[model samples]
Target: MKKLTSRIDKEKLLLAVAAPLLALVAALVVTALVILATGKNPFPAFNDMLSYGSASDSQVYILNKATTYYLAGIAVAIGFRMNLFNIGVDGQYRLAAFLAAVVGGALSLPGIVQIPVIILVAMLVGAVWSAIAGILKVTRGVSEVISTIMLNAIATAIIAYLLQPERLGQLDEAGTLVSTKPLPESSWFFTLDMGPAGQLWGFIVVAVVVGVAYWFTLGRTRFGFDLRAVGQSESAAAASGANVKKMIVTSMIISGAVAGLVGMPTLLNDSHQFDNSFPLGLGFTGIAIALLGRNHPVGVALAALLWGYLERTTGHFEVIGYDKEILGVIQGVIVLCVVIAYELVRRYGLKRQQQRVGAELAAQAAKTDTEVTA
Candidate 1:
């Protein structure tokens, strides 16, 4: 009985990891069925996607995409850890990209000087933008979710206004499109130079550095302890002399600063300009990635890689006469499945914990009775 109980307990703990894996499998099965219904060989289609997704050149593309997603995911995860919802990652990234582009374009210095300056300015811009929502939440009792959403809209408008020729010079002489002047070639990131498989190695380096810094900040720092305490119980944290408000604001700032890093891949690797079309909808997708990864740095990186692989391969489906919209469906299904699985596993764990505690209490009671009788 003891052995069986131990096995069951192990299985319950494994469920946290198993659930997402099962969700991915389930999603693929459903997708295959849908493809078969449409008179297509789902196996060949999937195999083709896999082949392309794993190719050397494709790996580089996916890695670049993963870098952006990972940074954005971390930003959302940081807020999630603090029980704060930062819905303004989109705005934060956009403003950061704009500032970075502006700084890069304006500078005429060496690569070392210009690159760091651009990145720093962008981070500062994003932090300030996100800090607004944090301040509103702390001071006026406004929900971060609502404030962040509204701030996102405001940031969008601000970016649009800044794209004007008078503010930031337009990319084209006519100023028809909403964009900033391109950066000097010296300001761009150095590519891997690994043939067709070459990638933005600088972005990957930055991601690793940021991930390490984030881990240290959250796991080893005094502020991290206070943030965790406040997250677990604000009232208790306050009673214990933790400044809950400061922690909340600090977390938000850090979240935004991390979010700003998302633009480095795009600005330094590809466009080198701030354009309306460049930012995309990465912020929202990042939230799903964060949840799927359980908000852990390693998990988030893996999740981002998976997402990037799917996105890159999905485009190839069109070449093989399949609908690319299937990718969207798959993404949505995966996210839904993962969410359901997480909730189920979480509840199961809670129940198991309760059961274990109850059993321990009963055993203690029996032992006491035995002692008293003897």
Candidate 2:
């Protein structure tokens, strides 16, 4: 029994890893085909990407980019684990960042106090925004997908309205752009100077912490089991004494809280203010990353890094005469491949388990027959 259990565990692990690897290989093949169709040698482009991506400066940049993506992926994964598709992560993080920036800018407190305050404010805003969808879903029989989409538009409008000179925004000395008041130098997040490689964001450490917490919460706690149970079957979960409605709301809130952190690496470490230049559409990217990673914490981190590497390398592809659309092609193909690959692996594993069970049962029946004959 112990040996059988160990074998099953190892097989499960292999299948889990195999899905992503298969997807990656499929994506690469498709990308190369596309590039060949474009009348260019695909090998050189791949070689260029690898060389550029491995450079020291590029490594620093990728790490910084991955930090933000890691947070975004985690935020989206939380919702995914509960079978929730939170399309509003983009808006939630944006609004949270803007508010946090406003608060950070207005405060003159020391770094220890001000930084935590800003982070907490971001989390609160994101949670409240996401909760709107959850509340509507439970109380009014609304779909979270639709509600969150609408909330995203509303959040965008609210930010546009508030970020004006007379409101929460201020004109920069350059007179070319309007933005939130800049956070004081005291409020700046710490960084590691990598000398020629550039400065690395300290927020990477925070992202690591968040990943650990996510793993712990979802794998080792009762709430995690309830959440997963609800995701699999709401009726069954309720029959098992779980409060379905409360779990929905709580999960959304927690997901949004993590989404809130998605913007901190940029706001606290780089931009130091909210402005029109603040990145948009990252919430959508989070969806792709979460899916690619199978919603696992460590998997999400690896997916985030892969995303960062692609973005960094593909942007340079434009400079080298490759069409910018290649990036889209690669990303789209990868997502499609991941979905298909995971489904195939899942079915294969299920069939293998069934076969094993059948064999074991047949062996037991044969043993019983022999004993009876004796």
Across residues 1-374, which tens digit of lDDT does each residue of candidate 1 receive? 47647866787769867888888888999889888888888998888887898889888888888999999999999999898888899889988898789878878999888999999998999899999999998999999999989988988888888888788856576646667778899888977776868754568889988888878888999887788888889999999999999989999999999888888889998888888678677889889899888888898998899999999999878888998888988888888888887887788878877887788779889999999999
Count of clashes in candidate 2: 0
Clashes of each: 0, 0
TM-scores, one per candidate: 0.91, 0.98
The 10-residue segment with the lowest total lDDT in model 2: 1-10
In candidate 2, residue 237 scores what lDDT? 98
The lDDT for every candidate, in the order shown, is 0.86, 0.94
TM-score of 1: 0.91
Pick the lDDT winner: 2
Off by over 4 Å in 1: 1-13, 36-39, 173-178, 364-374
